[model samples]
Target: MNPTSHHQGSQRCGLDALGQFDEIVDVRTPAEYADDHIPGALNAPVLSNEERVLIGTMYAQESPFKATRLGAALVARHIAEYLETIFADRPRGWRPLIYCWRGGKRSGSMTAWFNLIGWKARQLDGGYKTWRRHVIDTLAERPAGLDCVVLTGPTGSGKTRLLQSLGAAGAQILDLEGLARHRGSLLGALPDRPQPSQRGFESALLQAIEALDPARPVFVEAESRRIGQLSLPETLLRAMHAGRCVRVRAALPQRIAFLLQDYAHLFEAPDDFGRTLERLIGLHSRQTIRDWQALIAAGRRAELFQALVETHYDPAYRRSSDSHYAGLDQAMTFDYDPTADDGHAQARALIAQLRVPA
Candidate 1:
């Protein structure tokens, strides 16, 4: 682990270190918390979802004074009994770190109350928003020595699964897609989950990378800077794009089957297929969009996919791949048999190829 990642006192504790606190609480509402929070931060929202909605309305329609008046009464009502129970029989020496969305009035009030009772407490500066950006930057500013390799390929090429395979061979791999709770595309959002906040995403990335030896290169998939709702730390994205690419190719049928497996969730709600097509409208013609939407409405996902493949995915893949085609000399492209019989031999061959000096 990087030295700075471990120091909570320096206003720079990596999310991993902070996660180790005795009490890691997220003061945001359950809805806010549900939309991807730091994995372990307990939701002890100062405001309930409805209460937050009510307060937001007050802030928008009435004056800030009115909003504060409404907010205080509720927070005090909701927390008074709870705070008493939390501090009961405990000495003032317990340490806690409290944070709100922006580390504003809500968290400040809690921190002050904790301090008044003689407890050692600190308010997270700038709140969750600040910490999030810190996670992003920490990832970008690669701790000075960690070497890395990016596994580059088109959609549905089994990049994330391959990371696990590399792990079996004792290789370091960072599954960025898994970290972001995203496969890094418009259709990448998992069926019922949201991506992590940018900060949470960065913290996860940092923790994974810190576990590896910096002197040894680690494998990661090629991804755009933004992954679903979260953005990749710019520095790390730069490093990933700049790193040598290892190409993995599967025959057409195998690639399609891999896509189906990876995006199996989408098929369950097949009728909702239009959502992705709607998102891609800006990238295509109105007529093309309508035609695809019609296919989705008719429950012809196979036809819809074929339409998308012809109109969108295939062309885009070729264009994007062409631009960065310069590094082919450094690439180690390999094919895998779709049949199970050749799996081990193929895996061994790829691993052995990776063992060669880049």
Candidate 2:
């Protein structure tokens, strides 16, 4: 775990050893760090967002010499601030992993400063880009090593809730929609929180998969290749397709009730709901869309949701599930109640059933 031992000029460190460092520092600008960074890494930006933009503009339009001088000054000021505030109480043995966008000047400068101060600091080889590439590669290869149990059902059947319950009951679960910060549907967007970049989603997925034991069955909701704007890694998608399937079924009324509770946000923002519904314009007739809109306008959400399930979602689910899952029809069917307690009970029952080998 000695930082100097792994500091062979840009030699990539094993991701499994990330925990060896006392801290992981992201030296990218606030905006870049906000978009995504290594999980648990502390932000220690070498430049502010405005400063980065100013430097880039100067570098491109004015002169590289002037830009270099200005950038150096800014980096010095920021590093001084970190030393005074964030790293003020650090011990002599403090070991930190530093990274920037591409392991270039920003992280290098910080690492040099830390080394001069006598604390061991290593620059992440290839920086954030390297870590991102690792995530993409890991996701592409890792799922094949897992024993996945794919959960398939139409919308509003409480699949996500069931996954949570199962996880709480000691089952290994992969919540892809959660990692993507989406619900894997047209109206799946969470309020205020935007979905992560594709790289961010892959990073989260890689970490989640890495934590699971490959020998045990992983319970995961069956989803289309894409979740929001992110695409599933091909290997994970293939593993889901080939995995053993479990179908959760609920009555139309029960589904509408569950959806009403789950999508309360849609009710709070009627206009946003209307706009999202417009995405289905090509599939449903104008009159049908108008009718659904009227239901939203009239606050008849349950009725509208029922209509959507009967007309749009259920049909789409049937088509996609049958086409993708070879074991769809023969899947172990679990009938779920609309209530929370019943959902947990059903999850427990499913877990017990899964324990018996097929």
lDDT of 1 by residue, 182-291 (tens): 87767778877677766556667777776777767777777765778777665665566566677776665666666655665776765576666677767898788888
Q: RMSD of model 2, in Å?
A: 2.9
For candidate 1, the lDDT comes to: 0.67
- Give me the displacement of residue 253 in model 1, in angstroms: 3.0
Off by over 4 Å in 2: 1-17, 356-358
**Which digits, one per residue and each the tens of the lDDT, describe model 2 over residues 1-358?**
1222364554335455578799999999999998888988999999999999999999999999999999999999999999999999999999898999988889989999998998888888778887877776777788988777888888998889988888877788999989988998898888887999876777778889989888788889998989889899999888888888988888888888889888888889898888778889989988898899999999998899999999999888877744687777678988887555665677788888778321
All-Cα superposition RMSD per candidate: 5.6, 2.9
User: For candidate 2, what is the lDDT?
Assistant: 0.85
* C-alpha local distance difference test of each model: 0.67, 0.85
